[model samples]
Target: MKIQGKTALVTGASRGIGRAIALELAQQGIRRLLLVARNRQRLAEVAAEIERQGVLVVTLVLDLTQIVGVNIAIARAWRSYGPIDLLVNCAGVAHQAPFLESKLQNLQEEIATNLMGMYTMTRLIGRRMAARREGTIVNVSSLMGKVAAPTMASYSATKFGIVGFTQALRGELAPQNIRVMALLPSLTDTDMARGLQLFRWVLPMTPQQVAKVLVAKLEKNSSEILVGWQSHLAIWCQRFFPSLLEKVLRIVAPLSLSRSKSFGEIANRQQATGNRKGFWRIVLDFGFFRSNIQTFDKGFDQGLKDKFPD
Candidate 1:
């Protein structure tokens, strides 16, 4: 709908697709933005960029799983910054690994941040919007939500949950005149994606591309907006050739080992990383890492072995 002069709140605004979307919203003439993330420095960096575009910005360093804090923060932001007309739930964490190798902690983190966090934000803002009877909400899912991938089982489950929520919420909020939509971006070239093993043929889209598509699609009545040509083709294949698509997915799935030896062994092999970067800091600090890191290391080591055969 109409974005100009409206205020929006975007979670995960510290980086990746969320940051890009926040910037694009500013560019689209949204009057104000309330940016939320766990990292204050990154949020400030994003706020600076958005301010350059002349958008009023308010940044909140938050961990959405904290229910009471979220309640207080959201109420305060609404009172201080004014009511948010649009809410974009984009905060998420991904940990890729074989189902058997997955950890409960990582899965909990995924569900907590991706699904519960979105739910909390939506519920808080949604009630206000429903009262006012005019607002828009966008849930950022992933292509993996539509087509599950092998190494990314838990992450896929959380995304599927988001897609499900978007669908159900759309029906639930329709009578109140509040709009709910899903944005599915395929294999985005984000910090989270880079930590995983690359699939054979699929290409990753930049966060900016995803943001541009979201902004453009908001003008339409479409319930789901998917980014990139690859996503469209994959979804089309999934719709028509389910069996063949499964086979193709298997062929392109990343390498996985049958067993994990030990956590220490995996940590040592992380030598490939001289100094872990910002992404790793976020994940590790949040306890968001899984056997996926080990899986990636082993796969990388095995690929080297296969290529040079010592």
Candidate 2:
């Protein structure tokens, strides 16, 4: 469908890929945008930016994890600005940690925000779209959805769920003329990914590049949009060489875990929590497997370093 002159509701619109998408939509001459996120100030900032492009902007401070609250917010937005032409379910939370080290609270937060929140928003807007018989829904999934990564078990689970959900919704909504699509982007240079320790050769793209690719594909009736060559390659690897991919992941699992631990430590330090021993705690918490995994990771790390010396 044509993006120009369409009213779009974009969740997680305060920053990162969501922010980029909203701006892209504006640049494409979108009539209006309802920006939903927990950060009201940031939403206002984004609104101001979009306003400069002459697109009407509405900010809705919403915490997607709260089902009732999300429902209420959507209802209010709809009442105020009738008939959403497009819906972008992009609000999500991601946390990286080994399953053993992951806090239950953090895991729950990820599920509530990334999965349940999206499901709720999709269902609500989707019903209206179905009734109207014309609308588009874009669910921002991730490359991790196609291939689970170590130290991101919970996050990958949610993203994988999104892929399945989008597929099912597409089938159900197609007859209604309500388009449903999933966008899978590789590691992006967003604030959310700033703390992640990238693999040796993986290149991260900017959010703007991802947004540009996705927006350019909006007119096409594609079921899934892979933002970069990396995402396409990763999915291809999973499809044609599952076992080889598994072996590669296993080789990097220990390094991924260390990166997660390091990121957590950095976060703690930034918050001035002074938890200097957190890294050792992560190491010891895994028990007997820790040493063996570290040894395995060390050999592979050295090999990679030799092959791709910086």
Candidate 3:
């Protein structure tokens, strides 16, 4: 699909990869953008940035967890800004904790935002897109969607759900000339990435890099856009050497557990000291935090980089 002159709606447009994608789309000549996220201030900020690039931007301060309100907001935006030609479901939240230690609320919120939110937006926006018989939807999943990690079981579940959902939509919507794609970005340098405990060999990329890849994916009309070589390699291993990947993950589980504990400790200290940041925000904001093992995993990092040079 031609990105220029299209109106795109991007959720989670306040920060991180979502924000990057919005700007990229604007730069690519997207005529209008409906920016959706909870933070009105941040959304406005992003809107200003996009507007400066000569693209019209409208910010919707709606929480995806509030399904009814989200629907209403989308309706309002449609009424006000006209039909959205492209939809980017990017609003998401995650909580990093071992399965045993994960709180029920955290799990529910993760499902609500990461999985259900995408589903809700797609259901509503997709209907209109299908009616028009021409549109595109991009669902942002993660490398974890393909391969689960320790202490991030629930997050992985939600992301995996997104991948499946996008795949299903691809089949259902293809006949209507509506395209659906999944974007599986690895650890990107963002606030969200900074909060996560990552594996030894994982290297973080900038959100701008992800935004650029998104444009390329749009032009190629690719179904699955894996942002980094690390993601590509991981998925390859999962398909051809599943047992080896599983074994490596098992060996790393204990380290992941320790990282979870450290996160818990930090949360406790923040609470005790009355830090402005919420405990779960700190605990769940594991964007690209290196696993302690990464500090000493020189050969693993070097070998992977040598194989897949930047």
Q: How close is candidate 2 to the true structure, as a TM-score?
A: 0.83
Predicted candidate 3 versus true structure: per-residue lDDT over 1-310, tens digit per residue: 7888889999999999999999999988999998999999999999998888888888889888888998888888888888889999998887777788889999999998998889899999999888889899999999999999877899999999999999998999999999999999987767776566544434567789999999878977699999889899888878866655665565444365554434334445666988865433443444323443443355456546655679
The runs of at least 3 residues in candidate 2 whose Cα sits more than 4 Å from the true structure, single-residue gaps closed, are: 252-310
TM-score of each candidate structure, all chains considered together? 0.83, 0.83, 0.83
Clashes of each: 0, 0, 10
The top-ranked prediction according to lDDT is 1
- Model 1 scores a C-alpha lDDT of 0.85
The alpha-carbon root-mean-square deviation between model 2 and the true structure, to one decimal in Å, is: 7.5
Candidate 2 weakest ten by summed lDDT: 259-268
Per-residue lDDT of 189-294 in model 2, one digit per residue for the tens? 6778766543323456778999999899999988999988878877876776565566566654546555333333444453586655643543454332444566
TM-score of 1: 0.83
Model 3 misplaced stretches (Cα beyond 4 Å): 251-310
The lDDT, on a scale of 0 to 1, for candidate 3 is 0.81
Cα lDDT for residue 229, model 2? 89
What lDDT tens digits, residue by residue, belong to model 1 across residues 224-304?
A: 998899999999878866655676676567554333222223233454555444335334432323524554455546645
